[model samples]
Target: MALFKRLAERQRPVLEFTLDGEPASGLLGDTLLTAVLTSGAHLRGSDFSAEPRAGFCLMGACQDCWVRLGDGRRVRACATALEAGQHVLREPGRRP
Candidate 1:
Protein backbone atom coordinates (compact mmCIF):
# COMPACT_ATOMS: atom_id res chain seq x y z
CA MET A 1 0.00 0.00 0.00
CA ALA A 2 1.19 3.51 -0.80
CA LEU A 3 1.12 6.20 1.85
CA PHE A 4 0.07 8.96 -0.59
CA LYS A 5 -1.55 9.29 -3.96
CA ARG A 6 -2.30 12.00 -6.47
CA LEU A 7 -5.77 13.51 -6.28
CA ALA A 8 -6.09 13.54 -10.06
CA GLU A 9 -4.52 11.79 -12.97
CA ARG A 10 -1.87 14.23 -14.11
CA GLN A 11 1.45 13.43 -15.67
CA ARG A 12 4.39 15.76 -15.32
CA PRO A 13 7.36 15.98 -17.65
CA VAL A 14 10.03 13.33 -17.02
CA LEU A 15 13.67 14.16 -16.52
CA GLU A 16 16.62 11.83 -17.06
CA PHE A 17 19.68 11.63 -14.88
CA THR A 18 22.38 9.32 -13.60
CA LEU A 19 22.68 7.76 -10.19
CA ASP A 20 25.99 6.16 -9.40
CA GLY A 21 26.62 5.73 -13.16
CA GLU A 22 23.25 4.13 -13.80
CA PRO A 23 20.44 5.80 -15.74
CA ALA A 24 17.44 7.09 -13.82
CA SER A 25 14.39 9.27 -14.42
CA GLY A 26 11.89 11.29 -12.43
CA LEU A 27 9.27 13.98 -12.75
CA LEU A 28 10.61 17.40 -13.63
CA GLY A 29 9.21 19.26 -10.64
CA ASP A 30 10.30 16.65 -8.09
CA THR A 31 13.01 17.25 -5.55
CA LEU A 32 16.17 15.18 -5.79
CA LEU A 33 15.11 13.16 -2.73
CA THR A 34 11.72 12.41 -4.27
CA ALA A 35 13.33 11.47 -7.56
CA VAL A 36 15.77 9.06 -5.99
CA LEU A 37 13.27 7.57 -3.57
CA THR A 38 10.69 7.13 -6.34
CA SER A 39 13.33 5.37 -8.38
CA GLY A 40 14.17 3.06 -5.42
CA ALA A 41 17.58 4.62 -4.89
CA HIS A 42 19.08 5.02 -1.47
CA LEU A 43 19.85 8.66 -0.64
CA ARG A 44 22.93 7.85 1.39
CA GLY A 45 24.21 5.94 4.41
CA SER A 46 24.44 6.85 8.06
CA ASP A 47 27.83 7.81 9.41
CA PHE A 48 27.60 5.86 12.62
CA SER A 49 26.36 2.47 11.47
CA ALA A 50 26.57 2.87 7.70
CA GLU A 51 22.90 2.10 7.42
CA PRO A 52 21.07 3.37 4.35
CA ARG A 53 19.43 6.73 5.03
CA ALA A 54 16.69 8.62 3.25
CA GLY A 55 14.93 11.88 4.00
CA PHE A 56 14.23 12.61 7.63
CA CYS A 57 12.88 16.14 8.08
CA LEU A 58 12.05 16.62 4.37
CA MET A 59 12.42 20.36 5.08
CA GLY A 60 16.24 20.58 5.29
CA ALA A 61 16.31 20.79 9.10
CA CYS A 62 17.78 17.28 9.43
CA GLN A 63 20.82 16.51 7.36
CA ASP A 64 19.94 12.89 6.63
CA CYS A 65 19.10 13.52 3.00
CA TRP A 66 22.35 15.10 1.95
CA VAL A 67 23.77 13.77 -1.34
CA ARG A 68 26.82 14.50 -3.41
CA LEU A 69 27.19 15.39 -7.06
CA GLY A 70 29.67 13.78 -9.40
CA ASP A 71 32.07 16.67 -8.87
CA GLY A 72 32.01 16.08 -5.07
CA ARG A 73 29.69 18.96 -4.22
CA ARG A 74 27.06 18.17 -1.61
CA VAL A 75 23.45 19.35 -1.51
CA ARG A 76 20.37 18.69 0.53
CA ALA A 77 18.35 16.31 -1.61
CA CYS A 78 14.99 17.31 -0.18
CA ALA A 79 15.59 20.99 -0.97
CA THR A 80 17.17 20.54 -4.39
CA ALA A 81 15.17 20.18 -7.59
CA LEU A 82 15.80 17.33 -9.97
CA GLU A 83 17.53 18.43 -13.15
CA ALA A 84 17.82 16.66 -16.46
CA GLY A 85 21.17 14.99 -16.99
CA GLN A 86 22.18 15.59 -13.42
CA HIS A 87 24.61 13.15 -11.86
CA VAL A 88 24.31 12.17 -8.21
CA LEU A 89 26.60 9.97 -6.17
CA ARG A 90 25.76 7.97 -3.07
CA GLU A 91 28.60 7.73 -0.62
CA PRO A 92 28.05 5.34 2.25
CA GLY A 93 28.90 6.46 5.78
CA ARG A 94 29.58 10.04 4.77
CA ARG A 95 28.89 12.75 7.29
CA PRO A 96 26.71 15.72 6.37
Candidate 2:
Protein backbone atom coordinates (compact mmCIF):
# COMPACT_ATOMS: atom_id res chain seq x y z
CA MET A 1 0.00 0.00 0.00
CA ALA A 2 1.78 3.06 -1.24
CA LEU A 3 1.13 6.43 0.25
CA PHE A 4 1.55 8.08 -3.13
CA LYS A 5 1.25 7.25 -6.80
CA ARG A 6 2.71 8.88 -9.84
CA LEU A 7 0.12 10.81 -11.81
CA ALA A 8 1.67 10.04 -15.14
CA GLU A 9 4.54 8.17 -16.65
CA ARG A 10 7.76 10.02 -17.16
CA GLN A 11 10.82 9.15 -19.15
CA ARG A 12 13.26 9.34 -16.24
CA PRO A 13 15.24 6.20 -15.66
CA VAL A 14 14.51 4.15 -12.59
CA LEU A 15 17.24 3.75 -10.01
CA GLU A 16 17.45 0.64 -7.95
CA PHE A 17 17.78 0.89 -4.18
CA THR A 18 16.75 -0.88 -1.02
CA LEU A 19 14.51 0.12 1.83
CA ASP A 20 14.97 -1.78 5.07
CA GLY A 21 16.84 -4.46 3.21
CA GLU A 22 13.98 -5.03 0.78
CA PRO A 23 14.54 -4.38 -2.90
CA ALA A 24 13.07 -1.11 -4.15
CA SER A 25 13.49 1.40 -6.90
CA GLY A 26 12.70 5.02 -7.57
CA LEU A 27 12.73 7.47 -10.41
CA LEU A 28 16.12 9.03 -10.96
CA GLY A 29 15.34 12.47 -9.67
CA ASP A 30 13.22 11.53 -6.73
CA THR A 31 13.99 12.72 -3.25
CA LEU A 32 14.52 10.05 -0.63
CA LEU A 33 11.25 10.95 1.03
CA THR A 34 9.34 10.67 -2.20
CA ALA A 35 10.88 7.32 -2.96
CA VAL A 36 10.13 5.93 0.45
CA LEU A 37 6.52 6.97 0.70
CA THR A 38 5.63 6.11 -2.83
CA SER A 39 6.93 2.63 -2.12
CA GLY A 40 4.40 2.18 0.68
CA ALA A 41 7.10 2.50 3.34
CA HIS A 42 6.35 4.55 6.42
CA LEU A 43 8.47 7.43 7.56
CA ARG A 44 10.16 7.30 10.96
CA GLY A 45 7.97 7.19 14.00
CA SER A 46 7.65 10.31 16.10
CA ASP A 47 9.89 10.48 19.14
CA PHE A 48 7.16 12.08 21.23
CA SER A 49 4.08 10.37 20.02
CA ALA A 50 2.74 7.01 19.03
CA GLU A 51 2.00 8.21 15.51
CA PRO A 52 4.28 7.91 12.53
CA ARG A 53 5.66 11.00 10.85
CA ALA A 54 5.52 11.61 7.12
CA GLY A 55 7.54 14.80 7.21
CA PHE A 56 5.63 17.88 8.30
CA CYS A 57 7.26 20.21 5.81
CA LEU A 58 8.42 18.94 2.47
CA MET A 59 11.27 21.40 2.75
CA GLY A 60 14.31 20.65 4.92
CA ALA A 61 13.49 23.01 7.78
CA CYS A 62 11.27 20.79 9.88
CA GLN A 63 13.94 18.30 10.98
CA ASP A 64 11.23 15.68 10.74
CA CYS A 65 12.33 13.59 7.82
CA TRP A 66 15.55 12.14 9.10
CA VAL A 67 16.42 8.66 7.90
CA ARG A 68 19.53 6.55 7.83
CA LEU A 69 21.35 5.58 4.72
CA GLY A 70 22.89 2.13 4.45
CA ASP A 71 26.31 3.59 5.01
CA GLY A 72 25.23 4.72 8.49
CA ARG A 73 24.69 8.36 7.69
CA ARG A 74 21.60 10.14 8.91
CA VAL A 75 20.04 12.40 6.30
CA ARG A 76 17.02 14.55 5.83
CA ALA A 77 15.05 12.51 3.36
CA CYS A 78 13.11 15.48 2.04
CA ALA A 79 16.26 17.21 0.90
CA THR A 80 18.24 14.23 -0.32
CA ALA A 81 18.07 12.94 -3.85
CA LEU A 82 17.59 9.27 -4.49
CA GLU A 83 20.51 7.70 -6.27
CA ALA A 84 21.19 4.39 -7.91
CA GLY A 85 22.10 1.60 -5.48
CA GLN A 86 21.37 3.78 -2.49
CA HIS A 87 20.01 2.01 0.53
CA VAL A 88 17.56 3.65 2.93
CA LEU A 89 16.48 2.49 6.31
CA ARG A 90 14.22 3.60 9.11
CA GLU A 91 16.23 4.17 12.28
CA PRO A 92 16.21 0.98 14.27
CA GLY A 93 13.54 0.61 16.97
CA ARG A 94 11.69 3.59 15.55
CA ARG A 95 9.18 1.65 13.57
CA PRO A 96 5.70 3.05 13.53
Candidate 3:
Protein backbone atom coordinates (compact mmCIF):
# COMPACT_ATOMS: atom_id res chain seq x y z
CA MET A 1 0.00 0.00 0.00
CA ALA A 2 2.79 2.41 0.85
CA LEU A 3 4.56 1.73 -2.41
CA PHE A 4 1.35 2.18 -4.32
CA LYS A 5 0.67 5.41 -2.50
CA ARG A 6 4.08 6.71 -3.45
CA LEU A 7 3.43 5.95 -7.09
CA ALA A 8 -0.04 7.47 -6.83
CA GLU A 9 1.41 10.82 -5.84
CA ARG A 10 1.68 13.24 -8.71
CA GLN A 11 5.10 13.90 -10.10
CA ARG A 12 6.63 17.24 -9.21
CA PRO A 13 7.00 19.91 -11.85
CA VAL A 14 10.36 20.47 -13.48
CA LEU A 15 12.50 23.60 -13.23
CA GLU A 16 15.66 24.50 -15.13
CA PHE A 17 18.29 26.75 -13.60
CA THR A 18 21.98 27.13 -12.93
CA LEU A 19 23.84 26.17 -9.82
CA ASP A 20 27.19 27.77 -9.10
CA GLY A 21 27.36 28.78 -12.75
CA GLU A 22 26.53 25.25 -13.86
CA PRO A 23 23.32 24.23 -15.59
CA ALA A 24 20.83 22.16 -13.60
CA SER A 25 17.26 20.88 -13.57
CA GLY A 26 14.80 20.11 -10.76
CA LEU A 27 11.14 19.57 -9.90
CA LEU A 28 8.94 22.62 -9.30
CA GLY A 29 5.53 23.30 -7.59
CA ASP A 30 7.10 22.53 -4.26
CA THR A 31 8.82 25.30 -2.35
CA LEU A 32 11.90 26.57 -4.20
CA LEU A 33 14.05 26.07 -1.14
CA THR A 34 12.97 22.42 -0.78
CA ALA A 35 13.53 21.80 -4.46
CA VAL A 36 16.99 23.33 -4.35
CA LEU A 37 17.97 21.40 -1.27
CA THR A 38 16.85 18.10 -2.84
CA SER A 39 18.55 18.77 -6.18
CA GLY A 40 22.04 18.38 -4.70
CA ALA A 41 23.19 21.54 -6.48
CA HIS A 42 26.21 23.41 -5.24
CA LEU A 43 24.91 26.83 -4.17
CA ARG A 44 25.60 29.65 -1.74
CA GLY A 45 21.96 30.57 -1.20
CA SER A 46 20.15 31.56 1.97
CA ASP A 47 20.69 29.41 5.02
CA PHE A 48 17.07 28.38 5.58
CA SER A 49 18.14 26.57 8.72
CA ALA A 50 19.90 29.60 10.14
CA GLU A 51 19.78 33.40 10.19
CA PRO A 52 16.10 33.69 11.24
CA ARG A 53 14.90 31.75 8.23
CA ALA A 54 12.21 29.08 8.37
CA GLY A 55 9.98 27.26 5.89
CA PHE A 56 7.33 26.11 8.40
CA CYS A 57 4.80 28.38 6.79
CA LEU A 58 4.67 27.00 3.25
CA MET A 59 1.69 29.25 2.43
CA GLY A 60 3.92 32.28 1.67
CA ALA A 61 2.95 34.05 4.87
CA CYS A 62 6.61 34.27 5.85
CA GLN A 63 9.18 35.99 3.68
CA ASP A 64 11.55 33.07 4.02
CA CYS A 65 11.06 32.31 0.33
CA TRP A 66 12.87 35.50 -0.64
CA VAL A 67 15.39 34.75 -3.38
CA ARG A 68 17.57 36.88 -5.58
CA LEU A 69 16.46 37.16 -9.16
CA GLY A 70 18.97 36.94 -11.94
CA ASP A 71 18.32 40.63 -12.58
CA GLY A 72 19.53 41.67 -9.11
CA ARG A 73 16.08 41.89 -7.55
CA ARG A 74 14.69 39.91 -4.64
CA VAL A 75 11.43 37.93 -4.81
CA ARG A 76 9.67 35.30 -2.80
CA ALA A 77 10.18 31.84 -4.26
CA CYS A 78 6.99 30.47 -2.70
CA ALA A 79 4.78 33.21 -4.14
CA THR A 80 6.38 33.10 -7.57
CA ALA A 81 5.92 30.12 -9.83
CA LEU A 82 8.93 28.79 -11.68
CA GLU A 83 9.23 29.72 -15.35
CA ALA A 84 10.88 27.79 -18.16
CA GLY A 85 13.54 30.34 -19.12
CA GLN A 86 13.61 32.52 -16.05
CA HIS A 87 17.05 33.32 -14.67
CA VAL A 88 17.44 32.75 -10.94
CA LEU A 89 20.00 33.50 -8.26
CA ARG A 90 19.92 31.29 -5.17
CA GLU A 91 20.89 33.65 -2.39
CA PRO A 92 18.86 36.59 -1.14
CA GLY A 93 21.58 39.07 -2.05
CA ARG A 94 23.45 38.52 -5.30
CA ARG A 95 23.55 39.53 -8.94
CA PRO A 96 23.80 37.22 -11.91
Candidate 4:
Protein backbone atom coordinates (compact mmCIF):
# COMPACT_ATOMS: atom_id res chain seq x y z
CA MET A 1 0.00 0.00 0.00
CA ALA A 2 1.04 3.57 -0.62
CA LEU A 3 0.65 4.58 3.04
CA PHE A 4 2.71 1.68 4.27
CA LYS A 5 5.41 2.42 1.72
CA ARG A 6 5.46 6.07 2.72
CA LEU A 7 5.75 5.21 6.40
CA ALA A 8 8.55 2.80 5.72
CA GLU A 9 10.37 5.36 3.63
CA ARG A 10 10.18 7.95 6.41
CA GLN A 11 11.88 5.71 8.94
CA ARG A 12 15.50 6.76 9.45
CA PRO A 13 18.40 4.66 10.52
CA VAL A 14 19.03 4.38 14.25
CA LEU A 15 21.73 6.66 15.66
CA GLU A 16 23.44 6.22 19.01
CA PHE A 17 23.95 8.46 22.04
CA THR A 18 25.34 8.20 25.57
CA LEU A 19 22.84 8.95 28.36
CA ASP A 20 24.06 10.79 31.42
CA GLY A 21 27.52 9.17 31.75
CA GLU A 22 26.23 5.75 30.80
CA PRO A 23 26.44 4.12 27.39
CA ALA A 24 22.91 4.23 25.92
CA SER A 25 22.65 3.56 22.22
CA GLY A 26 19.44 3.73 20.17
CA LEU A 27 17.76 5.18 17.08
CA LEU A 28 18.39 8.83 16.37
CA GLY A 29 14.95 9.49 14.89
CA ASP A 30 13.34 8.65 18.22
CA THR A 31 13.25 11.37 20.88
CA LEU A 32 16.14 11.30 23.42
CA LEU A 33 13.85 10.20 26.25
CA THR A 34 12.38 7.39 24.18
CA ALA A 35 15.85 6.10 23.43
CA VAL A 36 17.04 6.42 27.02
CA LEU A 37 13.89 4.94 28.59
CA THR A 38 13.80 2.08 26.12
CA SER A 39 17.33 1.18 27.17
CA GLY A 40 16.04 0.72 30.76
CA ALA A 41 18.36 3.34 32.31
CA HIS A 42 17.55 6.10 34.77
CA LEU A 43 16.90 9.58 33.29
CA ARG A 44 16.27 13.04 34.73
CA GLY A 45 13.77 14.86 32.57
CA SER A 46 10.08 15.85 32.29
CA ASP A 47 9.08 12.41 31.09
CA PHE A 48 8.27 11.50 34.66
CA SER A 49 7.08 13.15 37.86
CA ALA A 50 9.43 10.97 39.96
CA GLU A 51 13.20 10.66 39.93
CA PRO A 52 14.93 8.85 37.10
CA ARG A 53 12.53 10.16 34.49
CA ALA A 54 11.16 8.88 31.19
CA GLY A 55 9.56 10.10 27.94
CA PHE A 56 5.84 10.82 27.56
CA CYS A 57 4.70 12.37 24.27
CA LEU A 58 7.06 11.68 21.41
CA MET A 59 6.03 15.00 19.91
CA GLY A 60 7.19 18.46 21.01
CA ALA A 61 3.74 19.52 22.23
CA CYS A 62 4.29 18.18 25.77
CA GLN A 63 6.50 20.15 28.16
CA ASP A 64 7.35 17.01 30.11
CA CYS A 65 10.29 16.27 27.81
CA TRP A 66 12.39 19.05 29.34
CA VAL A 67 16.10 18.52 30.09
CA ARG A 68 19.20 20.54 30.90
CA LEU A 69 21.89 20.45 28.29
CA GLY A 70 25.65 20.28 28.74
CA ASP A 71 25.82 24.09 28.55
CA GLY A 72 23.32 24.37 31.43
CA ARG A 73 20.32 25.14 29.29
CA ARG A 74 16.92 23.50 29.72
CA VAL A 75 15.34 22.06 26.58
CA ARG A 76 12.62 19.65 25.66
CA ALA A 77 14.14 16.25 25.03
CA CYS A 78 11.41 15.38 22.54
CA ALA A 79 12.43 18.28 20.34
CA THR A 80 16.19 17.85 20.59
CA ALA A 81 18.51 15.48 18.85
CA LEU A 82 20.33 12.76 20.73
CA GLU A 83 23.95 13.70 20.17
CA ALA A 84 26.54 11.04 20.80
CA GLY A 85 28.06 12.80 23.81
CA GLN A 86 25.25 15.05 25.04
CA HIS A 87 24.94 15.31 28.82
CA VAL A 88 21.31 16.09 29.63
CA LEU A 89 20.15 16.63 33.22
CA ARG A 90 16.73 16.82 34.85
CA GLU A 91 15.38 20.02 36.37
CA PRO A 92 17.70 20.40 39.38
CA GLY A 93 15.66 22.47 41.82
CA ARG A 94 12.34 21.66 43.44
CA ARG A 95 9.38 21.61 41.08
CA PRO A 96 7.41 24.84 41.43
The prediction achieving the highest lDDT against the true structure is 2
Q: Show the lowest summed lDDT stretch of 10 residues, model 2.
A: 87-96
Which pairs clash in the backbone of model 2? none
Q: How big is the RMSD of model 3?
A: 7.0
Model 2: per-residue Cα lDDT over 1-94, one tens digit each: 7787887666789988999899888898899998888886477777666366788898999998899998999999999999999989875433
Which residue ranges in model 3 land beyond 4 Å of their true spot?
Answer: 1-13, 28-31, 41-54, 92-96
lDDT of each: 0.80, 0.84, 0.52, 0.57
Best by TM-score: 2
Q: Show model 2 residue runs off by greater than 4 Å.
A: 92-96
Name the runs in model 4 displaced over 4 angstroms. Answer: 1-14, 41-53, 92-96
lDDT of 3 at 90: 60
Give one digit per residue, the lDDT tens place, for model 3 in 1-96.
010111332576677776445565555564455444444432233464333232445577866566666777776766666565456666633333
Per-residue lDDT for 33-61 in model 4, tens only? 65556665444523333554454566878
- Candidate 1 Cα misplacement greater than 4 A, ranges: 1-10, 94-96
lDDT score for residue 93 of model 2: 34
User: Where does candidate 3 clash, by residue pair?
Assistant: 13-28
Candidate 1 lDDT over 2-29, as tens digits, reads: 2223354338888999988988877878
